[model samples]
Target chain A: SQKIEQNSEALNIQEGKTATLTCNYTNYSPAYLQWYRQDPGRGPVFLLLIRENEKEKRKERLKVTFDTTLKQSLFHITASQPADSATYLCALETNNAGNMLTFGGGTRLMVKP
Target chain B: DVKVTQSSRYLVKRTGEKVFLECVQDMDHENMFWYRQDPGLGLRLIYFSYDVKMKEKGDIPEGYSVSREKKERFSLILESASTNQTSMYLCASGILYEQYFGPGTRLTVT
Candidate 1:
């Protein structure tokens, strides 16, 4: 069976530092990959999406890199702030489910002031 | 704003009772989904609807049933609520698979 794995441990970082999160998969190659931000007790909000053909995508202070060769995607948040503290999720889809994403367990991020 | 709304923010029901969790989306999206989030399990899909009066089974559908009568609404039914069914239920809508989620309903079966 296919599996998606994210950093299970919480990531602690300074308010102004960069936070990097990792998502890895085994036995599956999806057509597209996505990232979402989920605050405590709130549904996830869509972030940037990178297709299999794309190497990198950027939005504001966030950047995502998808490397099919490594079977992984890396989500980067630069100039992280206290408000950026939350659990980040990454999903993968075959493109047929209209973006049906197989998500990881998510990595909780806490930005220290 | 494009939004998905669940019928309740929190619910408590007795075991063996029939429970209903409703979801309505304003976006008129072609696809709607039901998911339950647990502490370490991440998000697990329970069911989904592609169109009105149409449905599909997701990874976890054993204890749940769904209803889609109109384009903007989807409901989840727990025929006999059980203690193990206690979890956060989420509703989502989207086109072509990039789903947007509702705030979620935290259900507790006692």
Candidate 2:
């Protein structure tokens, strides 16, 4: 069976600082890794996706890095704001039919102003 | 933008009662998924349909069943709900890579 792990502890950081969250997986090789932002009582919204061949991807204020060798992915929010406080989840494409995904126990980030 | 809508935002049911969760998508996507989110377990896939009448069991499908009679609608069924079945249920629709999720349905089974 495959396993995904994220920091179960909540990460607290000051606003405008950078928040880094980690996701590690074992026993499975994924083709694509993705990050999602989930607010309390809301469904997760897509953040970014990186292929196994890619090293890093960046959006406006979000960056995601994939390290296949380490079976890990790092999600970063630079210049974080209080509104960025939410649970961040990492998912790996199961590479099977229908493009199913396996998600890690997300790390909740609390950005303080 | 793709829109996914679930029938309920919150639900309460008793043990051994039959429960149904409905999801509809306007994107006409071919893939629809049902997942349950728990406190520490993250999001676990219960079932997914690739096309009409084609369903696949996901990681956790033991206590759940799904119906996809039409291309745009998918339903998750709990034949006999249990207390342990209480969780946040989410529906998603996607073509291949990116998925659009609906406002989750918080289900509480007592």
Q: What DockQ, between 0 and 1, does each candidate earn?
A: 0.77, 0.80
Model 2 clash pairs are: none
Model 2 TM: 0.98
TM-score of 1: 0.98
Q: Residue A34 lDDT in model 1?
A: 92
lDDT of 2 by residue, B1-110 (tens): 88999999999999999999999999899999999999878999999999999999998999899999999999999999999999999999998888889999999999
Q: Assess each prediction's global lDDT (C-alpha) against the native.
A: 0.93, 0.93
Question: In model 1, what is the error at residue A49, expressed in angstroms?
Answer: 0.8
DockQ of 2: 0.80
Per-residue lDDT value at A84 in model 2:
97
